[model samples]
Target: MSRTAPAPAGEAAPPRPRRRIPGLGALRESGRLFALAGTTVREAFRRPFQTRELIEQFWFVAAVTILPAALVSIPFGAVIALQVGSLAQQLGAQSFTGGASVLAVIQQASPLIVALLIAGAGGSAICADLGSRTIREELEAMEVMGVSPVQRLVVPRVLACMLVAVLLNGLVSVVGTLGGYFFNVMLQHGTPGAYLSSFSALAQLPDLYISEIKAVVFGFIAGVVAAYRGLNPRGGPKGVGDVVNQSVVITFLLLFVVNVVLTAIYLQLVPQKGA
Candidate 1:
């Protein structure tokens, strides 16, 4: 058997070798985030619920995200309409421009817009608030007093994010669709009747379903990611800012990847309106 050498007086011992696995840290963080999401969901259903906290968080998230959602949606819809109109005209399928543009906005743009706004505004607020509590040891104090911070705080915020994202998805869809219609009819000289008729003929209920589902999933992801970073900020109080920025970036990346996956799966499973 090999024996380890002892350190001399007033000298520190040699550091032990650590097993470094590639991507282990990232895998561990992903696991923790998923665990946190599960805990939040479980705690969300347990009473006594944080009704007031949920309401306040919902209102606050909506307050911060509402105007931005509207503002962003208008430009997004206009661009989509213009691009689709140009393409359809080139293909001699100009009558289908409204259908194509509205479908793109509803199926793709709206949920993404809601996710970006929520992740930017609401997620940052959540991370900052929780990170401050964490650094101040308020979460620790609550644990000592027998309160589960996930139940009292995280759950409400997560629920609030979900509720607000769903509502905002609807808001963006309406505003964006109207904006697209206006741009197509007025700027592109598209007949209003043709635009409305084409949309009605091509738009299916499944498109709306997928959009709302994406919003809910994106909301849950944003809330969980922000809470995870907030609860595990490194380097003390100063690190909270870094964590907040990281959470937003991470959420944005996750949203796009998830959107692609969801869209692919929906296309595979749900048949098109006329197909």
Candidate 2:
């Protein structure tokens, strides 16, 4: 006997196409983050304590960026000083240009700029590598075999970033100060002690403290964002390339936006009325 035919088009059918669920990917990603983060933390502490992975990751992230950050800071500082000096001169206040220069670099520019560089170069590299592995199912293979990819893959990078970015930012701040110091002290005939004094004067404890805070936060964000983007590529696997590029873009934009908001918050809390 012939089976009853299914309902015709435009009529009720045995079953409608399953409704496309919203955020299938997102829900999956959320679970992945939890799984990834949990495994990362566990492996982070599971070692004999202070293992080779931690050391290697620390070197990888921090060492690679040190030279670039140092090189960039010099020009960055010089440009800042020249621009601020020109503006001050026009306003008949050239005497205070050093103060302005130091303030510009340390207050927000130095650390924030450092964050951008590492986030673009170092962070994006991590994304590309991991994304490639993820798309090829290398991560899946690790999972199926009882290996934790997140622990081996994610934790080292994240830990590296927090350490490296801070160190890089510190280098940025120091080298930048030297550029301003040399320009003000050597070429312009300003006293070395006076230059140091001026720079030091501009950096109150609160300013330096806030700078450290910014470094850690931005570094952590860059690391986590890169890892997240990389581990969750799209297009069924061919999207790895785009994932790396997008990670860089997102890291940069997010860092810049966060920098602005942090600066505003600091200004409000610091109370400029007295000074």
Clashes (candidate 1): 0
Model 2 lDDT per residue over 239-259, tens place: 877888877887787788889
Worst 10 residues of 2 by lDDT: 194-203
Best by TM-score: 1
- TM-score for every candidate vs. truth? 0.94, 0.79
- Best candidate per lDDT, number? 1
Can you give the lDDT of residue 139 in candidate 2?
95
Q: Which stretches of candidate 1 lie over 4 Å from their true place?
A: 1-15
Error of 1 at 191 (Å): 1.0
For model 1, give the RMSD to the true fold: 3.2
